[model samples]
Target chain A: MVVDHFEARLVKLARKGDQGAFAELVDLYKDKIFHLAYRMLSNRHEAEDIVQETFLRVYKSFHRYDDKQKFSTWIYRIATNLCIDRLRKRKPSYYLDAEMNDQEGMDGYTLIPGDERTPESEYLLSETQEMIHQAIEGLPAKYKSVIILRYLQDLSLQEIGDVLDMPVTTVKTRVHRGREFLRKKLENKVF
Target chain B: MDCKQASSLMHDYLDEDLTHGQAVELKSHLKDCSACNERFKELEQTEMVLFAAIKPRSITASDELVDRIMSQIPNQRKQQAWIGWIRKHPALTAAAMFLFVMLFSAISLWESDDQLVVKTADLDQVIINGNTVTVPSGSTIAGNLTVENGKAEIYGDVQGNLTVIDGSYYQASTAHIAGEIKSIDQALDWIWYRITDMFTEVAYK
Candidate 1:
């Protein structure tokens, strides 16, 4: 990714307690981080929480930032870690609770009302999106991140490696495996 | 390439990470193998769906999120500003610190030392009696003259500068000085004189 030239100046100003600069930085990254978190967690509310917590942690740990790393890499690493942590916490009892809710005809999506649509084509489009989301949500956390970062965020394999602190070769392998997993899960679904 | 290798290349090709040579090889393999060709099509379809479904959403955080984050940041203490400044300009701080130490040491040395000293390359031309030094009339000194903790009475010519520290100089009407005469009566003045003298020596060299 092309690093923003003004980003370093903003980071310097923010480090010195320029709240306006910090707010500009937040504005620059808010949507990207939100979209990454939303795709990773597949829940709007939890994704929003991840976004808030990621920036909060970034603020608290500004002193620890090493300038050698790109600010985007640093922030994405924080947001990715937060999403992984939330996913891990959702594993034991929360996982069971979610499954139970699904059995009780209360899948998480039902809580939010669907958008009004008069055209059958729009309904089909939403269904395709729903199918794609389900296929991705079924992936293991490891594969899910690589797939979302690769296709959804369009990060280069090397950039993803830096954000995830993995070797480029390892990132390539995960991306391949993740793609294969998606292909298998999405084989029969009509797009 | 075999089917397994072809399968991996297809993924690389979809990601646009394949080299031209590898792409050519994968293309030939897919042409020759129906199974791999079918599999490649499926992978392509999956990627297309992924891009079509997700990229359009462009989910954004609500406006209150930025405000909430700003609210959580504790106010930066006023006293830390200097610390931040020092952190930002370490080289400047170090230079200032070095100058301060040099000034302090010069003042302490001045306070600790009280002795009568006279410096002149042509000391033979100067007459010393007790704490008083005299350059008699019509005798010329070739170089700079420095006197400390004493009195200097000049009735002759000086070819270079004359400096008096913690002392005084009296020049007669006939005395001719080709250079500046400086008197240092305080520690601060002494320090300034030493700094300028050092710089002058460096500049001359």
Candidate 2:
């Protein structure tokens, strides 16, 4: 609660053209937004780009932000929307079933980025973790966002709804369906 | 409990969204059903693995990224400050805009209004020829004289204030006036005169 009050104060100060306050906000959410974008896009450079663009947009449109809503939710919504936009641009015909067919022909080694497979990094990400990441990368954008927000960001169902501008029931259904999809994808493999 | 009810409860349990009673029921069912128990364990393992894989990486944005974002912000802040000033002083901004528009239109109207007009209560006492109004020698006018967009020559006058708008007035050496002569050439002065004239007309009416 004290942190929430401090964050609200920072938002108020930033809205009044305080650059230092805005920098503090950026410092606070930069890694969180980057992690979200990285999970969604599976690309480090693009994730960084998303982080930059999200903060730029947030700074540009501070007046539109409603003080009643959670600032974190609003920032997450911006980051999520930017990540989705980049995903859609990467694959214009991005359908739920389309990527599944494409994944079958591709090996897991090829699915992982070539430059990211350092020996230490490979040791850090176990086979199961790598498989889970690949499965998540292949999920449809709709399910992908909810799953990441729920499991990764640890947002509540209500916070996810607010961020996605959807009802809590819809968020619940998506999270369930997303986990079920992951369960099916990882079925018959090592738990 | 049936397998279907148990599966739904299992998902709810994983989310930690289930009521305590529902969780207890699901727990009891898992104990009784081997297949449901196995399925719940796999789901729980998947949840755990997912949490491990997606847990916040120690990924921090580089100082260069912060510098890039901060460098871009000063430009936007400058523009926002200007817009914010207008937003903060809406009434002053609106009044300034209104005054600007009114001044602009008044100037345009004055420039476009070039038709010659002459008014006098005693028209018979003056000679009107072309765009010039002349009070001939030894002629006495009883009332005020106003001329617009035309020259006014007063040789002899015994009248109220003589007003010339957007035109020059010539008073001969023999000219005599009972009141002050006023010449309005600027658009702003003409507008002020028109306003006062309207108020006086309204009062008289």
Candidate 3:
């Protein structure tokens, strides 16, 4: 509901060439786009560029939006396609196991709640997060795209179908396969 | 349904796309089947953990984003398909006419960076842009400049002589003048001085 309300107001102001309203749209979706881009590219700077570029494009093309489409779905399509394009051009990983770039976007990604927790628990959580990221990254692009959209971006199946231009039945099947992949990869795993 | 059929349809079942009759049939099958029951339990646990592990995490953009994007926005002359209406529904000439009018206005209001901006550093032979120009302290423009809509800030020094077609020039205390300086604004305000000193200043200038 909050997202819907924001979308409505942003659509009105953004249609009239309002930069401030466009900036607000950036603030709203920047993190979500950044997460997807970062996961896909495994690079912080590229992800940051993707976020800004995504917003700039939305600003440039906002006037054409039909308002019938959900704003989240529209933005997800943009980010997902951009990520796919980046993936298509990237060289295959030389190594099966790549160290995650924790140093790249240092402190840019905040862990939600770690206060008063012991170091061991926090370390486990961070390692777990990294392991999950690595496992998801290793998936084939099609499967990875859907999983990240459904799990990471929190889009529903229908919304993901809209974003990826897939039938909802196909989306569900892909999600199940993706989840099974994660299950195998993460099974009995530890740092 | 046996375990295989039930497991295969688990995703559909969980999605609740199953019709009432099919759902009833499946529920009865699960009730009587042991191996299928275990599979369901396994699926339920796996679903719980996977869903728990995949909560959406928020990531923040770096603060330099605005700076980087703004820097690119300037000097960006690439024509974009605005709204795509012009290309998409070309049968509508009226829309193109409206776009042409807006484009004309934006262009007339447009200020070329080279015309208005001048760098303050000989090595600062930077272009000044806008209606007026002023060199800022401790900065250099390394190339020719243009300006359209605003003024310039020159605090440091200019490598090349400055040229501006219009607009006031504000030279700060920290400003250094290396290149030849000219201001259209200064002429009007300093007309008396300029006129009186024209003869003496003509040869040097």
Model number with the top TM-score: 2
* Per-residue lDDT of A94 in model 2: 40
Model 1: fnat (fraction of native contacts): 0.67
Off by over 4 Å in 1: A1-3, A96-125, B56-59, B75-205
Per-residue accuracy of model 3 over A109-149 as CA lDDT, tens digit each: 33235522122123334666666666776788899889888
Q: Candidate 1 residues B114-144, lDDT tens each? A: 7889999999999998999999999999998
Indicate whether candidate 1 or candidate 2 has the larger TM-score.
Answer: 2
Query: Ten residues in a row with the worst lDDT in model 2 chain A?
Result: A101-110
Model 1 chain A: weakest 10-residue lDDT segment is: A115-124
What tens-digit string does per-residue lDDT give for candidate 1 at A1-191? 24576999899888777889988998998889988897777666677789888987887778899988889999999999999999998857665554333222133553557722122122334666766776776677888888888877888999999999999888899888887887887788763
Candidate 2's displacement at residue B190, Å, is 3.5
> Candidate 3, DockQ to 2 decimals?
0.18
After superposition on all CA atoms, how large is the RMSD of candidate 1? 11.8
Clashing pairs in 2: none
**Global lDDT of each model?**
0.81, 0.84, 0.64
lDDT (Cα, tens digit) per residue for candidate 2, span A68-101: 9999999999999999988887754543333544
What are the per-model C-alpha RMSD values against the true structure? Answer: 11.8, 6.3, 19.7
Clashes of each: 0, 0, 45
Tens digits of per-residue lDDT for model 3 on B16-124?
5677887777788889998777666655555665555555444445666765655454233134444454677776868768888966754454422235343323433
Which of the predicted structures, 2 or 3, would earn the higher DockQ when compared with the native?
Answer: 2
Chain B TM, every candidate: 0.51, 0.61, 0.33
Candidates, DockQ = 0.36, 0.52, 0.18
Q: After superposition, which runs of candidate 2 have C-alpha atoms over 4 Å from their true positions? A: A56-64, A85-126, A167-169, A187-189, B18-33, B62-99, B108-160, B163-175, B183-187, B194-205
